[model samples]
Target chain A: MSRNLFDMVWDMHKVATLSTGQDQLFIGLHLVHEVTSPQAFAMLAERGLKVLYPGRTFATVDHIVPTDDRSRPFSDPLAEEMLGAIERNVRAHGIEFFGLDSGNQGIVHIIGPELGLTQPGMTIACGDSHTATHGAFGSIAFGIGTSQVRDVLATQTMALDRPKVRLVRLDGKLGTGVTAKDLILRIMAELGVDGGLGYAYEYGGAAIAALSMEERMTVCNMSVEGGARAGYINPDDTTVEYLRGLPYAPSGEGFEKAAAFWKSLASGPGSSYDDEVGIDASSIEPMVTWGINPGQGIGISGRLPRLEDLEGAERDLAAKAYEHMKFTPGDPVKGRKVDVAFIGSCTNGRISDLRAAAAVAKGRKVARGVRALVVPGSKRVAAQARAEGLDLIFLEAGFEFREAGCSMCLAMNPDKLLGDEVSASSSNRNFIGRQGSPTGRTLLMSPAMVAAAAVSGEVVDVRDFV
Target chain B: MTITPIRSLAAGRGIPIRENDIDTDRIIPARYMKGITFEGLGEFAFHDARFDEAGNPKAHPFDDPRFKGGSILVVNRNFGCGSSREHAPQALEKFGIRAIVGESFAEIFAGNCTVMGLPAVSASGPDVAALQDLIEAKPETEIRVDLEAMRVGAGNLDFGISMKDSYRNALVSGTWDSTAALLSNLDAIRAVASALPYIGGFA
Candidate 1:
């Protein structure tokens, strides 16, 4: 039997074998958001069910909260109503909520870790797909639908089939300017979009261990893009160190005990995985998604694949991408002019991401025609960036520094692309109209690359910034 | 806690969406999900993909008159690939998609369909391609998905389909609405939670 962290955590939470042959898994942490929770709450009310374990659930507003002008009764009535629903629901259920004035509010994935609520060996569930971002802390976290959210609320457990574990080991170290974003993009590219369909990815090896907690999050955040519902790294000293002194984490002796328990959950010698795949990290370059899906990516120095180079479904999707993006196959990816530049999302909106972007924007000005925006993932991240003067650097460079929210990533709020504008975005997902405009184009890259594109007015390599 | 058992889907007209990796955003754009409830989402299903900024109808299968009132959706590989938004499947369900036949589906999307009592079944690539072609060629052809028989039938053609056995069981047994089944084991859940070191702060 597989003895990895995923298997162990899964077994620990397995409540019973349901009639359908699925395991009834107890959810340790249930994160809720504005967009997907209201209907679930309504369903619970209709069923006359009360929240089974209110303390285990946490709520926040991100999907529809306006990153700019976040005053009451948001200019958008629907957005305001959605926010109100969450506020009322959390209050009624006694679930802790990090609202606008809470000073802890942010993207659900970002706040979960920053507040220390996301810990090792815990099974976390959220309605948003990016919930896999929590897996960086060695937790088993995955996204669920509204009905599953209702189940987690009414019963504190969900019926799920166990997914096999795929050990994705990355050897060597990433080169300068090649970030965790690039590492994950390359993994998605090699694995295709549905490669991890029924598997949970256990990311390990020297390169994974070398990544900081935020960097690891960036890697695990996009696990869903490669079709893995959950991805995680084994807890180590770095994991413990990052959790130390956080608001929700245990303190002093309790923390030491927690740390030992966390370390014990790591897959040890002779542990086996269902499958193993290894890649050399040093070979990966800064990646950019040229197509709608996250898998349609290439290294910064590479050119788009020609039609004749692909076959079957791959060829068909490439043909569609070329027509939709209006880019010729076999053309160089660099020097493509961009109209907007966005830096923020659950994927790359933390303090570290802002610092990396600021380092690039320090002595540069945004291109004359480009509109750039920097959105922190949470209020805490924004405060930390301001304290470090990263906001000043971005503002001086002509980038609009806005309040923390999902922002241009999903474009549920007012932040959106206009017309057929092309954007260099740090947010995950370049799906058609994902940036809020059906014709708008997005080039997925790291925060630094987004900064470089903002300054150069085109798709340029971040390595050139140095 | 009760749900309608979905043992098999009766013959119905199929809508062909022959494309690989059709993401959830394309099914229902994020803007339309701003509403508090999934009500009235059917009209907005595939909103951006079927209409231009000016609200002019685009050349989409959903807008094509031939596929009007289609209850089954025939698609290519990796359908519903991005974003775990239940709105995507809910939009399709509200738009009258009772069952989905595709080459493959994202795990979360398929799971969402199951809980909602909608069946998202899969077949071989060639089988799916042929089915899509058949649907496009004759939009009035009746298609039936039989979970008990593990096959899809239309005219004299029969294609073997597969789904997660657990999902099939849940649907066939009307246990797809799993909240009741999970809640029934509260004692076991409490026992498991108490034994876990993290739940009690590892003290």
Candidate 2:
């Protein structure tokens, strides 16, 4: 029987089927960070259980770590306590810790791939939602709750019901200035936020296959926003090349053997899908979210959705979004004022993402009254960007170049938007108050689009500036 | 380590929220997640929608006196549509909501609810609308969710609910406890881990 890549990897990882009928899937890697793991570790301790397979687990402090200052004893007591707890827990459990000073420390999703810890034909679990970022390597990665995290720590496995596979095929080439971020935003807008429920999205076709590894990561990173349990691009030469020399990757002839094994895991030509959706990459433009959710998006030049065109619950949601966003139906998304422009997150914080943003920020100055920031996804990403002088380019354009952390993404740290301040962000989620203030508004866009917003002081097409 | 089986929930008053796509953010805002524990989250559930800027009470459904002690929440399509935060279900579970019947639910949110022993069942859009109307018409009327029969009923109105067989069996047999399942398969898990080259080395 022909099977898609999702089923292939899932079947490979199946350890047992419990009497409850859930598959006991072995996790090849488990990533943890400060915010979610402390409670999980505490839960394990309450049960008097040690980490069953500490070798498969890795820890880092990202979510609550302050981007501006790296010194210990953070200003936020809760943040400090959470970091302390993870540090102690990882040390006691014999799990690898990528601490604040570990140069490898960054967002858990970013560090995993860059270190080659995320590999094809593997089942990776994390306590963070963006674990789908590792799916770029053709791994089956999904976010789990703290209790599930405890289960993984204590048994190196998790119980899950298999999800049906949906093929999201993107053919043709992306137009100039369009990015993987734009592609995903366009997909979410077309599919609606809840379209991928109960399905594992297998992203493929010419456009997806053409994307660079970092770009692929950006595309897979936002799969959760579209309600997919997981999303993956099948392993190919691009994936193999990206993993070749990473610190944790296999070396020399072992690399060749691993790559061959990975190649075999791709869906065969006769593979079938439960459902398939075709998208023309050329039809997409520089996309931006105008409303509260990631699905409430339009092309930079497109107008807001008309409420009259929608019906029932969708109409109500659009109305609520318009009221919350202060955007009028049929109005252009371009020229909307932005108070802040943020360029970073696990979504678009790679070296390539920084280079793209720097290209837009090189010659122009940020518009007066607009506060812009450039945060790297990982310490290694930060170092690479600095070596290439991307930091200087951003700094010269009046953007604050900060340390590596999940800054302002959830605003668990000090960096946050003031009340009702509208921001142009390159992060994944645009949920209400996601950027800090109770009513702060976030418009999700590409990193270059964020740079364009910084210079224009409003949402604008990145193609116009580039 | 066994979870208590929840085959059937007792009949109870149902609260109706006519809104669709009530995301996790609206359930419990991100700022409230800074705490180490989930304690006291019940007070802040729907904090923004339930209160005005000056901390005055608003006309949100959770704030209505009629639904103060409602144990069942009937909602519209795509309830809990954003974020994978378990806190959303935790807050709902703490806020006296024992069961949720909606037009649909986000997959992760539904999974989170199952883990918390709060059953989130789905029905058709018209059936959900009818359920909401029934609840609004008689807020004190008792509604029962029968997992065994895969139906929810209130008076003469009953709607068929759908859930995955695995999730249904887990909820009914108390095997929803993932910890217990993991422990039972520990030896198999170790064997799998030991076979992987990456896990064998690097420690």
Candidate 3:
């Protein structure tokens, strides 16, 4: 019988069927970061336990790391303590540490793929919601909690109930100025934020097949926003080629063997799915979120939905969004004043994302009064951007080219929105207070759109500026 | 490190919040995540929703004197919608809530609650709405959640709720303490880790 990619990978990782009826799945890779792991490590200490499979785990600092300055003794005492705790915990447990000085240091999701650590047919777990980012490589990745983090560290296995598989196929060619970011925003809008509940979204079809490895990562990264436990694109030539020469990837003949195995993991022609949805890529335009949730989105040229346009609970949510975001119903998103323009996150902070934004920023200066920032997802992405002088292009455009970290994505660091400042952000999660302020508003858009907003100081259509 | 099993719960009052899709960010705003521990999270539970910009008290359900010590929370569909922050469940648990009955729950949030020994049971939309209405009308009514029978009782209303068999067995059998179970299977885990080339390469 043919099986989907999710079932194939999940079957490979199933360690045991517990008496509780959940599978004891062995995690092939466990990624940890500063913010969530400190308490987990402490939990292990309290239990007098050591990392049973330290070799399977890796640690890095990202969430609370200050993007502007990396000097020792961070301004925030809590941030400093969290970082210090992770450093000690990793060292004591004999796990690999991607410290601040390490060139490998970056967001856990970004570093894993760039280093060839994320591979097809593996189960990866991280103490972050965006761990779904690794599913781009055809692996089954999950964002777990601190206690589950401890479970993985101590046993390299996590108990989980298997999820049904949902096939989200996007066909046809994407129009110019449309990107993976817009495609995902469109998916979330069409399928409500909770649409993918109890399912693993398997992304396929012509449009998804055409996206680069980086673009595939961006699409998978936001699977959590759609409420999918995980999302993935099948491993094909694009995936194999992207992984070929990375540091941890197999070499030469070994690479050939690995590629062949990865090819076999793709969903077979007759593979079945619990549910399926198809999207016409040609119909999707540059999308933007106007409400407090990622699902409340509209095309850049389209007007915000009136209260009457929405039904039931959504209507109530629309009213709350209107009051919080200060967006007028039925008004076009264009020309809405933006206090900040941020172009970075694990979702769209890869080299290609920066290049796309740089193309928009090359000949234009940021509009006065807009605080613009471009943060790379990883140190390697930062190094690559600087090598190509994308950093200079952004800086010359009056955008702050900052160090690699989560940065303004969740704004755990100092790069936060003040008061009720509205921002055009190329990050995921537009939930209330998500950008570090209670009343602060975030409008999610593509990186190029965020750049256009920086140049125009409002939510203008990127097509106009490009 | 075993978590005490939570087999059954009986609460004198249930706090009802009619809003749908109450995300984790609203339960405990991201700013409060700066701490190194889950301690003291109770005070900050619903900190933003319950307080104003100037730190004044707001008219939130949690703040009502009638529901001050409510151990059961009744909410609308898609409760705990975003973020895998266990802090949301941690806050609810810290705020003295032992169980949650909602129209539905985001998968991760419910999982987190299960591990923390906080049972999150789900009922049909009309059943949850009826429970909320009944609770609001009579705050002194007793709300009972029984894991063995898989039912919720409030006054004359008896609503059958659904829970994954695994989650229910874990809670009833005290096997929900995942840390202990994980630690017990160390050898098998090591064998699996050794078989993976990616992990073996590290060694």
Give a tens-digit lDDT track for model 3, residues B61-178. 8999877788899998889977778888998889999889998888888888888878999899899989889878887788998888889999999989988889999888878768
Among incorrect, acceptable, medium and high, the docking class of model 3 is medium
Every candidate's lDDT = 0.93, 0.87, 0.88
Best by TM-score: 1
Best by lDDT: 1
**Per-residue error (Å), model 2, residue A85:** 1.2
TM-score rank, highest first?
Answer: 1, 3, 2
Tens digits of per-residue lDDT for model 3 on A236-272? Answer: 9999999989998878777887888888899987999
User: Candidate 1: which pairs clash?
Assistant: none
Worst ten in a row by lDDT for model 3 chain A = A8-17
lDDT of 1 by residue, A9-110 (tens): 999999999999999999999999999999999999998999999999999988899888988989899999999999999999999999998999999999
DockQ scores for all predicted structures:
0.91, 0.55, 0.57
Off by over 4 Å in 2: B1-7, B195-203
Off by over 4 Å in 1: B1-3
